[model samples]
Target chain A: MYSSLILLPFLSVIALNLPFRNLMKKLAFVVCLLVLLVQISLIVCPSICIWSNDLDIFGSFLQFNFAVDNLSRVMLFCIGIVLLAALFVQRYIIDDEERIFNFVNVLLLILIGMDGIVMVRDIFSLYIFLEITAVGSFILIGFNKDVDAFEAAFKYIILSVVATVLMLSSIALLLIVSGSTSFSSISDALKTSPDSLLISSAVAIFLCACFIKAGLIPFHGWLADTYSAAPAAVSVLLAGIVTKTVGAYTLIRIVNSVFGFESSINSLLLVIGIISIVIGALAALGQRDFKRMLAYSSISQVGYIILGLGCGTTLGLAGAVFHLFNHSIFKTLLFVNSAAVELETGTTDMNGLSGLSKKMPFTAMTSVVASLSAAGIPPLSGFWSKLIIIMALWMSGFYVYAVIAILASVLTLAYFLSLQRMVFFGRLKEDSANIKEAGLGLMFPALILALIIVAVGLFFPFIINTFILPAGNILGG
Target chain B: MRLFWSYGLFISILCIIGFYCILVTYNLIRALVGLEILIKAATLLIIVAGYITGHEALAQSLVITLIVIEAVVITVAVGIVLGIRSHNNSLDARKIRNLKG
Candidate 1:
């Protein structure tokens, strides 16, 4: 039944690209939207009998080793939400029918890729899906065909390939010791030969690859350029879920299931998480471009997720997953708002624009909601996740790390305030008075995301019990 | 064990050459060639791992899938390079630095 998540998108992309070009072009967006909506509905209500019945038709032809736990469920939900937002934003921004069709095609491919990433049980299968997602993103980034987009795409290609080589080498080494590429087999092998240098090196290499993929501090040079230079909708997709799915989520899943959270690994995650939080925030404080600053802030927020994961407790794991969900929501909201601003104002430079809220009320209000949530204000989703992570850190006796997390939250707030003041709240620049509100295409996703942030925050206990705590259960497995 | 050591040494050297090629080259195409070299080394490593572990069939299947994926990636990379060439009229990596800070 779960295999349908991967197969439905795969089949849709194939069916949508059939020889009936004119008809397919007209129907592509609706079909893709239906696929995504079905995905969301299926995950939200897994007891749906029709999906299971439909799964059997495809199941006979394709044998996939997919296992979906609560963690995967949360990630699947995020992927669906973010992709839906990206699809809508793409439709709103790109006017050419042919280009929009191409965009939809690649978008479905990425959907298949990320869905595969979240559910695959075999390590090699994970690599294949990671490549699929990476390749899709590379094309999307360079889709605009501008020089900067090309340069950013090339840099991403080089760095991403490097990460890939490292990961493949690690997988090969693991295969030598474990004789199998399944997660269970490799993990069993590691448990038996816990102290071997071979296993340790393989684990370390894999971790480094994941960090690069995730765009941590040291390997993050390509991230901001890719995010800020790509097409607006592509930025929303990349920043919102691409890096999180391929990098951070992979890191979390592999560490928990395959590597088995040793003290050394925990400390390494802690140290790296702190550096990314501090450096990403400090760097964001000085950025002049609106998108670049948000990109850096994304790094910082992802750091908090890593911090929570590094705590090595069930509470910490739950907090980490919750934060991942929150970061996806709020970050997508922020990027969507940035896209709206860039579309309307003709520039994302903070210095060039002022007082957009006067013209674009919906974008402005939703951005404020997103910014406040991202900065971890009370009664927003970001606050609850941050609170849980800090409490978990404190309870685990990592008081210093907890304190740093708090201080970094303040830093987050400072930069966001600056962003708000520069773009939304200042005196209206004379040249910007002609700017109008973005269309319903952009405003709709922003409003939906903002509502999610607030609702998740206000209904914290219900979310924690139903969604978050179940996420923690994966740690035991 | 000796077979493993010998293959490992060769693989490391290949990786070094690949990394050096990527880092030292000014031409974007050359950097891509370097990436290819790196992947070839990984592929070789996988083949050798399978040989040593007696899982030759599994390794063969994985490598086949890997090769297909690799071809797709390189094709995309080359297309991107062509796009870059079209814009700047050059493939020099140094010239492609418009996106700073």
Candidate 2:
């Protein structure tokens, strides 16, 4: 039955392309909602697949061998929420029938890839699923087929191909050494102390590929460009959870289960995390475009997640997981807010927007909530997660990283406040007289997300106990 | 064993040249050629690794899957390059510079 989690989305991709355009849109939305419901059910019941020989491809079992652990549960929940929001917000932004159809189709295909990536146990299968996600994303990023979109997509594909090539080489090396591609087999091989430089090189190569995927400092060239150039809904999906899932989650999982938390790897994560935090936030401060700022903000925020995981403690892992969830919610909310602004104003330049609060109260108010949370203000979801990560870093004796984390949060606040002031709080622009509030379709999801941020903040203790702690336990205590 | 190591060394050179082509070349098609070279090196490494481990079947399967994925990726990439060329009238990477900070 867990196979249905992947099967439904795969089916939806076909259903999305059906001839009746209007029906396809509604069907696509409904199907995504149903997908959310299925995911929620999985979270509640929590089934696991030890092994399944159903497909028997290459005379090897590859069907539904899902490891529905706590980590997968958290990710599955976030994916459902993010996809639902993306599909919902998409209606307001896109009008072309063919574009809408293609958008919905690719989104569903992405869902299939994501579900497989989180659920699969074998490392080889994980790479396949990651590629699936990457392929779908490449198409979606260029879905508009505009010159700018295609250019961004080309850069994305080039970087992704390089990363995948390195990953394949690493996998080849690991396969030769371990004689198997399963995580268990590989971990067992590592336990025997293969004191060889080749092994470390393979691991380093794999992590480098993952870092590239995650958009760390040295490997982040493709990130801001792709995020800003994609359509707003696609941007929301990409920034909100795609990068986290495809890059960070996979990295954390491999580190936890396969690599077993070597201090060297931990230091690498810390250093990269610190660099991304400083670089991303500083870059964000200089962006004129509204969405572009958010893209850089995403890179910075992702730095915190990695930093927390790098601490290599249970609390640190919990903080990372919690922050990952919090980041997805507020980031998607902010992007949705951006889309609403863009919808009414027809531009995302900060200078072009002024006193938008008067015209679009829902978007303006939600943007405040999302950005405030993102800036790590007290009594919001982002604060608790950031605090946990900082506490984890400090407790682990990484005082320097802890300081960097705090400084970056202050910088986060400064930029987000500037963003809020520039775009929403100033005098209403003279050219903005005819602008109106965004439609309910767009406003509803942002409002829902804002509410979630508040609710998660208010109930932080319960959420940590129920979700984040279990996820951290899976990593280590 | 020596033969496999030599093959690995050769693949490494191919990969380094491919990467250099990708990072240094101005032409989009040359970049694509670089990508192809990188992929070939990876495929060869996988086969060699599989041969050394006596799991040639697994390696063969991985190579097959990699080839299929590579084909799709290259096709899409070529299509994207065509789109870029048609839109910008140049296949030089420098030509498609509309997006920046």
Candidate 3:
């Protein structure tokens, strides 16, 4: 069953590239749906499969174990849903048959990569999976074949190469000290090592590389460009889950499980988290384009997840994980809405759009809900996660960070509200007056996401009791 | 024994220079060459570190993986750059700025 999780997508990539052009899109959707069904079954049974032993992928005796812990469960669940939503959105965005077909093939390849990343135990396997996901995204980002798309792809690939090289160097250093590439051996090596300098240096370099990978404040130059430049479906994948899995998840796992989240590391996370939160929100406030603003918003929201992790408490980690799920749902919903608006009005310039609420009520209402959720308004899913994060900070005696987090939440509200006003609320623009509601292909998946936002919000206690607590327990160790 | 550490540090400095080249250069090909340099440095470091710790087998396998990954990345990257060149008629990073805030 675990092998199928990777193998199914691998198979779909081949199926997607077959000569049957007419069947490509349908086949892609069906494959993604099957994958989602597999994930759901995992959630339902929860013990039908337990992957804990080492295996080799290419007969090299390199260890490739898949651990189905609580953390991986949450990530696998989220990635499954997000992949379906991405396919739903992708079908409508790309006009050319060839591009759409290739997009599906590459997307499934990426899904396999993400699933492998979340499931794999060894650091080397994680690095391989990360590269697979990166390579797929670079191609998908440039799928439009326009100057802007290629430029963004080039920037993303360049920065990613730098980050990966740094990661490789750190891994090599760790291998030298540990004599093994598996997480268990590395942790044991750290425990037995006589010298702190080598371990600390390796950890430090690894952290820096992760920051670049996650597009944290100092290394976020490529994020907004790449997010805004990619096709909307690709944007949904990139903004919603790619960075989370590739960067944030890896950082959380390595720091918590391997390095044990020391106070100094916690402090570094706190400082960087706060910096990204402030800078991302402030930079977002200055954006004129819809998708670009959403890109910055994604950066700011990811900061919240990082901040929660930085607090170094079970509650904090719970909030981070919960917010990670919530962000994926509502952010993907909002980006789909942005895609809808762009499709209808032929542009995403906020200043040039208005009164879309009048013409496209479904979209306008969904946007309002998503934006409010983002701003941490009460009764929305975002509010509960942000509240938990802030409470965690305060309880942990991070008073300053708690205050800044609160202020940033308010700033989040300011920008998203202005976004609502600019894009949906004012008098209808002359050109937008004739715009119709988005077709069901777009609306259905978004509606599903919005429903999830509400469901997660309304059933907050149940969710926390079952999902967040167990995941947090795993991370807290 | 001491020479190994010095060689590692020297390679590290060369890696830094490559990073600087990536940061300062506007040409995509130059940046890519810089990336290649960084990869080469990392490959050497891995071998040297592995030798020092007697985990040369593990390091050799990782370096092999690294080499394959580097090849894939460079191929995809150059593919994109060539596409950019065809579309925009320039390889300078400054010339490709169609999507900015």
Candidate 4:
């Protein structure tokens, strides 16, 4: 039954491309929506038992090993919500029937890749899925055929291939030490010889690759360009979940299951996480482009997630995962709002726009919710996760790091407030008087995401016990 | 152990060459070739690991899949290069600086 999660999307892509071109083009959106909706529903109600039974109908033919835990379920839910939002944004922005069809096809392929990434138990299979997601995103980023989009795609491909080479080299080294690529065997092998130079080098190299993929500080040159230059819908998808799944999620999963959070590794995560938080926020403060600023904020938020993970406590891990979910929702909402602003006024430069609240009230209102949530304001979802991480850090005796984390939260709020004042508030520009609200397609997703952010923040106690704590259980297992 | 060191040295040389090519080249096609060289080195490293570990069959299959994926990635990359060429009328990395902050 779990195999069906991967298999169903794979089959849909195949079926959508079958002859009957006109008909498939018409049916593509609905088909993709159905697949995503079913996935979201299954994860929402795990008591259904159909998903839990492990009845693999394709077991005899395909020997792929897949298992899901609380961590994977959280990631799956994020992927579904973000992708659905991207789909709706695409529909409203692109009027060409053929382009929409192609977008849906690649979107489904990415869905399949991300699902496989979260579920696969083997390192090599993990690599395969990561590449699949990378390739699909490359196509999507360059889908608009504009020069800037092409340049962005080219830079991404070059860097991505470099990361892939580094990752594969590390895998090869691990293969030599463990003689197997499966996570269980590798973990066992490392336990027997944790101090070997070979094991340590392999671990370092693999972590470097993940850092590059995740767009952490010092290797983030391509990230802002890629996110801001890609088509609007693709920006929402990439910024929302692609980087998180491939980079941050992989780092967390691998460290927990395979690397065992050694002291050296924990320190490395701590240093890099702090650097990303400080640098990403400072960089975001100076950006004029709306999407680029949001892109930088993404790096900072992911830094928080990594900081929590580095604390190496169950509470910290749970906080990291919870923050990951919250970041996806609020970031998607912010990007959706950016798309709405860009569509209505025909620009994303904050310097060119002012007083959008009068015309595009929904976009402005939703953005305020997202910005406040991102800044760790009280009673919002972001505040709880940051509190947990800081508390965990203090308990773990990283008092300086905890203080820095609090200071960075102030920095986050500073930049977002500036962004609001620049783009959404103040006197209406004389040239922008005719602008109006964005269409329902964009507004609907923005409202849904805003509702999630508020609901999650208001119901923190319930979510913490039922949804987030279970994620920490995977660490011991 | 001796065999591993010899192959490691060779792979390191290939990687250095690949990095140099990517860093020094101005042409987009040359940069892609650099990437291909890097990938080839990684492939060689995997095969050597498999040989040392006596997992010849496993390594062979992994290499095959890696090659197929590499081909697909390079093809899409070349398509993007073509798109870039059409827009700028040149492939120099220096000319594509319109996206900087």
What lDDT, from 0 to 1, does candidate 2 have? 0.87
Flag regions of model 4 displaced more than 4 Å: A49-55, A475-477
Q: Which residue runs does candidate 1 get wrong by more than 4 Å? A: A475-477
DockQ of 3: 0.81
DockQ of each: 0.93, 0.81, 0.81, 0.91
- Per-candidate total of colliding backbone pairs: 0, 0, 0, 1
lDDT (C-alpha) at residue A261 in model 2: 84
Q: What are the runs in model 2 whose C-alpha is more than 4 Å off? A: A15-26, A44-64, A475-477
Highest DockQ scorer: 1
TM-score of each model, in listed order:
0.99, 0.95, 0.95, 0.99
**First chain TM-score in every candidate?**
0.98, 0.94, 0.94, 0.98
Cα error of candidate 2 at position A468, Å: 0.8
Q: Relative to the unseen true structure, what is the C-alpha lDDT of residue A76 in candidate 3, on a scale of 0 to 100? A: 88
Pitting candidate 3 against candidate 4, the one with the higher TM-score is 4
Write candidate 2's Cα lDDT for A375-405 as tens digits: 9998999999999999999999999999989
Judged by lDDT against the true structure, how good is candidate 3? 0.86
Write one digit per residue (lDDT tens) for candidate 4, span A1-477.
667778888889999898898999998899989999988998898678666655465644556678888999999999999999999999999978899899999999999899999998899999999999999999999999989999999999999999999999999999999999999999999999658888899999999999999999978989999999999999999999999999999999999999888889999999999999999999999999999999999999999999999999998899899999999999999999999999999999999999999998899999999999999997999999999999989999999999999999999999999999999999999988679999999999999999999999999999999889889766443
* Residue pairs that clash (backbone atoms under 3 angstroms), model 1: none
True contacts kept of each: 0.91, 0.72, 0.78, 0.85
Off by over 4 Å in 3: A15-26, A44-63, A475-477
For model 1, how does the per-residue alpha-carbon lDDT over B1-101 read when each residue is reduced to its tens digit? 68998999999999999999999999999999999999999999999999999999999999999999999999999999999999888988888778988
